[model samples]
Target chain A: MIDSINPTAKTVGMLIGSIALGFTFHWQLNVLLSLVCLLFLMTSKRAKLSTMVRVLIPIAFISVSYFMTGWLFSSEQALFSLTNETIVAGGRAELINGLNLGTRILAFGMIGISYSLTTDSYDLIVSFIQQAKMPMKVGYAILTAFNLTSLIQTEYEHSKLAIQVRNLPVKGFDTKPLFTMMVRMVRWSERLSLSMEAKGFSEERTMHRQLKIKRRDIAFAAGFPLVILGLGMILAR
Target chain B: MNKKELTLRDYLLMALISVVFGVFYLLAVYAGTALTTVLTPFGLGVLGYEPFYGIWFMAAIITTYLIRKPVVGIVTEMIAALIEVLLGNMFGVIILISAFIQGLGVEVAFAFTGYKKYTYKVTMTSAVTATVLTFIWTGFRNNYLAMDWRIVLAIFVTRLLSSLFFTGYLSKLICDKLDEAGILNSMQTREVHDR
Candidate 1:
């Protein structure tokens, strides 16, 4: 169901939702938002549980680190006191703040994963051109690059292999292979543009996939943030 | 056709290079996350990602150095961030905003030189500008302002060095190497002649 939404609309909705999430520093709200995002990801057909887990492992570490650092260096530490009772209270407050910082990372990771796992790269570009008003030329250029990614990967491996075979002195910061790669890519770009021109490619061309903005898109765009921020307001108290 | 305008080849090269750097950006994030976890006990987790921030800006720097055109840094950075999003970057759409702002920093530095000079000083200037601008943005987004002053300073210093090393010095080295090897001769010659 999430994948069915236009990628542009989904992106806008999530972008606003993520921005809203950023301003919020409440742990409860962050946890709630993360859980909601996790639920979306879990239900989405495109998000494999294994991939999600693999991605979340590092995010989990970062989140924990944030929590620890947030506790120790919290700005609220300026409220220092000598009294034992006040010390304990301050410590607890710092802990809560730390949790807030930590959970914020989780929330963001979940939100990002929810969007990225479900969205298709090609569809996203198409939506960018069709809905976001991106120039067709830019869109096509990006698509062309997208197709070259695999070739680029192979080229990178070949460069590395060539370095080993040639026994080049370049070790850590070798620019030789990078230069080679860039030279080849430059030639490829020149040829690609020429061939595209020869094939009569133009900005006036039509797209095979037409992404439409439905009522659901509007609802997701507006409602996602409204729900998250509204809950944040209620939970902050 | 304006002589200074970017052609299809320029756009394609920018896109392709951005794609490569986008992958590097992902690797840098992993390294950063690991570093962050290691430093978490010292209450300086934010500093972990500082070292890798330069890698994020490399696409912009390298593209601009090679292209020697106005605003190529900004456009290349934006495209790199777009590719990152497409590649499932964990930071998601907010990175797009960060990219645009950081690109502006690189652009401002080059703008001061009237977009003519691609010297080492100019490249380092852009790196410093990008580091400071992006740090300010990150501080706001990550609540770094609320952290202890020492931690903030550390983050800034580490980030500046990282930016200088990777975006400034390293990119300059690579571009110069390409030029020395005659690899950039055709592209540079065409652009110089066109100008």
Candidate 2:
């Protein structure tokens, strides 16, 4: 179900859910969304277990860090004082605030994982160009650069080898190789663009893959957030 | 210098710049996350990412200064975010929002300089603008308002310094190197010859 939905729709739906998640600090909502996103990913089986575990480990640490920060430095002491709440209640509010911060990270991380793990890069760009009205030039440039990533890595390695061959001190953060690669990049970009123009690449061309908005897209886009909102309201105490 | 139009070459250059920095941003994110874990017990985890905040804006600064065009900062930032998403960033869609806001801030700062001054001061100003805008956004998204003012102040200050060094000073240094290598000149010459 997750994989078959349009990439753009998944992106739009997740983005809406995230923005809505930003406006409040309700721990319940955060936890619910996080759990739902995790379940969604698990059921899809698109993400490998090892990858999920690796990503979640860092996320869990970061979320715990956020929890500690929120607990230690909450600015709501005035509210606790003015309301005349008991110390225990005040402590509970701080705990809730911290939990909210912690779980918010989990929710966001899960949402991001779901979108990235399931969506293909080429498909996403196609969706952007065809369904989202992105300019052809921008879309193609991105696609080209995306293709160049591996080449870029290879070039960097070659530069590093060249430096080692020259018997120069190779630091981890040396900029010489980076600058050399960048010069090559300038040349490559120019040649690529020229070749593209020579091949009569223009905006008035047909796409081989025409990504369209389907019923599933609409259902996911609208229903994802609505379900979250509806659940939040139902769970509101 | 009627070279205001963004040609395909310019877009491709922006794409390349974003791709390079996108990789760097991921490294920074990992480093920062590790640091955050180490510092969580001290309630200073928010400060962990501050040191890398400058790297986040490097693409925007370099693109604007090198391209010297309107909206290059914002566009490059957006492209960087897109690439990161494609590279499987765990922050997800919120990063897109940060990209827009940070890019807008960089654009506004350079716009203040009329896009003509590529000085250290100008880059620093651009970095500052981006830092403040993104900090405010983070404040809301990360619930900084709920944190103590002292911690908030500390995070802001560290971020400001990081931006000044990494985004402003380092990007200017890189651009200077590029200029010295005559790479930028080649770009301009090609554009002029094409016309």
Candidate 3:
């Protein structure tokens, strides 16, 4: 409820953080961004270590798969052969490979965790639209999406239990039933959207936020480019 | 049969399942190489299910299973795959192609059944569909033929089982659970196999 207030700082922080770490895949850059995320997690009273851990588990898998796939796919120069004729795959360590995809994911996850921790979804969207010049339509759409994340979680749990209690052998997926469910869900969202429209709840939101681009906001936004530049230089050297 | 419209609750359930499964997928990958590949095949075997081919099997069947709308599953899966691509992976363009082809495969399963029924058989059918489409992708990527055909066949079978067990059955279980909990509207429940 209180999330209806200021959420600009955290959103801004997330933006700054992701841009710094999202794309380029250098171990040094990843280490740096990860450390920054760690720093925020450690210092931000709002941040929860458990939630961060939850997000990290997937990131870890994704990155490893990236690496493992590289290993399996390698037909390049051999580093050193074992007693067997199997030679080392030299092309595996390209830092920017998919395995190191943790950068954007880390950025997104950190941003998500940081946002959830620091501010409620309400404030986050409002601040984005009103303060940051993010279009009100996009802001509200995202806000609504975020707001319902928990609801989605609950409903899923509910359906699972119902299936179990029915004494049905609800174990494997059939293309038939799964599709049936998705169609149902989309319909509901549409109805809800329709209801919102009927109530004159339009995407025509005109709430202009009043956050000034403070010195800190400017500095924060500028920081990522400079860091990327510095890292770029370091890598070149 | 007509495609049913789901409530927010339905989407949330699917999203939650995706999230948890994603976490589990990560664990599987970690288990694969982090002393896991050495253990059971299940631990890190998912590592083989990279952003490319595996997603097709996953998204096709998954989206198909959850939405029941023929192309929706494929399309949503494609969107999800695009999201992954935006995040970047080893096979960039390949991911998009797999999504399209895989979506086509899932769509085919629905088509074969005439979209007339939703049952475990169809799920398995689509699971196989996903496997076959993915086989083509693997063949294209040279992942299939490069390894021994026997080993490749073994991988395909393992993926088939995983799809059946995890992607196929689990999706239905989770959906049914959500449906009964009153979280899913009675209407949504009515669209599929009624309990």
> Scoring each candidate complex against the real one, what DockQ results?
0.59, 0.67, 0.08
Q: After superposition, how far is residue A37 of candidate 2 from its true place, in Å?
A: 0.6
What TM-score does structure 1 among the candidates reach? 0.92
How many residue-pair clashes does candidate 3 contain? Answer: 42
In angstroms, the error of model 1 at B134 is 0.8
Residue range B59-176, candidate 1, lDDT tens digits: 7877777777888878887777777777777777777778898889887877887777888998899889998899888876776745667878888999899999988898888888
Docking class of 1: medium
Error of 2 at A135 (Å): 1.1
Tens digits of per-residue lDDT, candidate 1, A1-237, equal: 688888888989888888888776677788877888888888888888887888788878888887887778876442242122234553686776677778988888888888888888899999999999987778888889878888887887688788888886554345666767777777888789889989988788888888899999888888988888888777655
- Cα deviation at A134, candidate 1, in Å, is 0.7
Ranking by lDDT: 2, 1, 3
If scored against the real structure, what TM-score would every candidate get? 0.92, 0.93, 0.49
Clashing pairs in 1: none
Which stretches in model 3 have alpha-carbon errors above 4 Å? A1-26, A57-120, A127-141, A157-167, A172-177, A206-212, B1-195
In order, the Cα lDDT scores of the candidates are 0.79, 0.81, 0.48
- Candidate 3 displacement at residue B85 in angstroms: 16
Interface RMSD of 1: 2.2
lDDT of 3 by residue, A1-237 (tens): 112224564444444444444334354566566566566556765545775576566555544543443334322221122112333244434323323333443444444444455444454446656676754434443344444545654655555566667775544332333333454555555565556556665446455445445666555556645676568567544
Can you tell me the DockQ of model 3? Answer: 0.08
True contacts kept of 1: 0.56
